[model samples]
Target: MTSLTPNTVAADAEGLTLIISGDGIGASSMLQWRGVDYPIDWIVDVDGDGGSLGSAIPASALAIDGTFETVLVTVSTGGAASNPLPVTIFGPGVGAAESAVAGAGGTVTASTGRLTATYTRAAGGYGTLTAVDYAFPTDPLLPPNPISPVAFVDLQLLDGVAGDTLVGTFLPPNPILPPNPVLPPNPVLPPSPIRLAYWTGTTWAPVSGSGAVAPTFSFDWATSSASSATVTFDMTSTPQITALGGTVIAFVSAFAFEGFSAPADSDINVAKAGRAVPLGWRILDLGGNPILNLSSSSVDVSSVRIVCESLSGEAEPLDAYAPGSSGLQNLGDGYYQWNWATEKSWAGTCRLVRFDFGDRNPDGSPIYRTAAFQFTR
Candidate 1:
């Protein structure tokens, strides 16, 4: 091969073509990655001699959590392998101090967490993009929904030219470790229901919608309701961000069944002294799969527990219900429910009652989805 065009790309990038401008081009020519030969997508030859050949990389083949990684690109034909050309595949999560995309000026960084994101600056991108701090620029650092956030990322940039765009795909790091942070994590595909919010000088809010919520940017969510999200940060309104070089922080929280549910995440429930209230939700893994235990009629009960706390954070365990009981049990397909019987002594008192689901993470960590509420009787 003589030359390769557009050899560099960010991790998890898609729909990109790699061009090879070399000699000995033939119909039998093919592209190879990781010793596996894939069919050439297309080719352009001149006078049947030497012309540019084209091949594409497999999906998610270049996805990585660390940067400065290199891959060798080669074209093979007639049982002979051409010389390997080094292609730089820049990754994310190389530490905040050293995290920068392979490009002219812009930089990107992410915090050390499972839920993370990687950014790609558009061709019209400009300016000095600095660090990615997980914070809100204004008061009420979080949104009103879900009560808390799984992770947050702030994209800091300045002097950005108009019409500059950025495509950021957010998912768990390592693609699958400590819980299998795999790209497009299984059972959870694109259109993942990931809750991404921006601090709108007051509270964390969603992108634009039909509710007259003024758009912060063009939200092109490629995935949702699962474990990943992709959005394009259109910098057409760069002025709104560059309030004297202030950073525009974007916060994201996944709506996986792993966190907050029962009284529906920070909600309040009214109960009678002798009434039974059902606390139930569909339990899901980080990847959005139902935690099924077909061996038993009920859902796995070993990981379920309940606790009650006072309004001032005084806590104590309450064994009102447990699995294999008369009224509390797993309903199957990862759904757990309990008809909580409110005792007469629990009436007229404000208490924070929480149900801790003992679902585990891929790394064997004691991960649990909790449902807490102000139980007022």
Candidate 2:
């Protein structure tokens, strides 16, 4: 059999097509389709030629809603019979059709014409869903029905002092809410379980504190005017960040609805560090490259400070330094250094260091880092 497109065929609608080709049968050969030698009446060969035959079977002749293994035999005028070709068929209601796609950190699948979508963030970062489209052939009288409109979401990762949190805005299939109540509500229907997960580069792992827990992720319908609701992944209660980079996928499923979405290029950055100085520190980009030059006559530094917290939770603040400050030294190629003798007090304990760099561009956001560190004795 050349093609067995669908697992199940609708009795009143379209059926299956079987094509056969061989050199053993001649033009005068008779092609017979049967269930174990008992001929079936539904097989109609478009061309009666022997060497190759294409037959179309109607749904009504498939007998009942069950499995059918039909065999095709070709008998030539010379009394020679070709090898039997077996084809399997299933009646309507046997199985449903499914399709899916994935974004930066998400996936979507359809089962039996039902749609489901999911999103996850493994390394705890940001992501977004761009678009979604689907169609179904459920009704015989009408053309293939489309899911119409698309769904989207904006995911933001907030690494706060307390813990990490994933905030997501889920845009429904329809962006504009209907002023009149004639149209159905957004989401059409809410997906069940509203799962959040992280991609392990190989597979998806469910996020911690996902079910039956206080401070777990929650989805509400009226959180935003442009979305079904806002979904917040409570990373503070159960931290899910494992590495510096990875994706996240969230899944939502319902009887007639299912879909998934992933952020685009949602990779977390590993904080960069420079050569050490006695009680001093330097910060650089991932490539060991420094930020824009701050020592030039035209370049102005707004502010720079270091926040230190010891393992015992003792917090202290370091003095601000500028490019030409007394303990701050200008290193060639945009790199600068800061020295503070007071850092010696943070010895023998895990210390958390945060470096804040403010540039002259008032409108631009200041650069900051929490992962930078320098152990002191």
After superposition on all C-alphas, the RMSD of every candidate to the true structure, in Å, is: 16.8, 22.6
CA lDDT scores, all candidates in order: 0.44, 0.31
lDDT of 1 by residue, 1-377 (tens): 76766655656677446777678855578877757776765545634655445776765677654333445667888878786654545435222211233234434443233223333344443343333333222224233423234344444444444334444444432212233334333332122323445555555445422222232212222231234444545543322323313233343322245443444333344444445555666655333457553223322233222343433332332323333324445578767566555555665554434443332232324334433333334
lDDT for each residue of candidate 2 in 133-154, tens digit (9 for 90 to 100) = 1121122322222212122111
Best by lDDT: 1
Q: Give the Å error, residue 226, model 1.
A: 9.4
Worst 10 residues of 2 by lDDT: 257-266
Runs of candidate 2 with Cα error greater than 4 angstroms are 5-8, 14-16, 20-52, 63-377
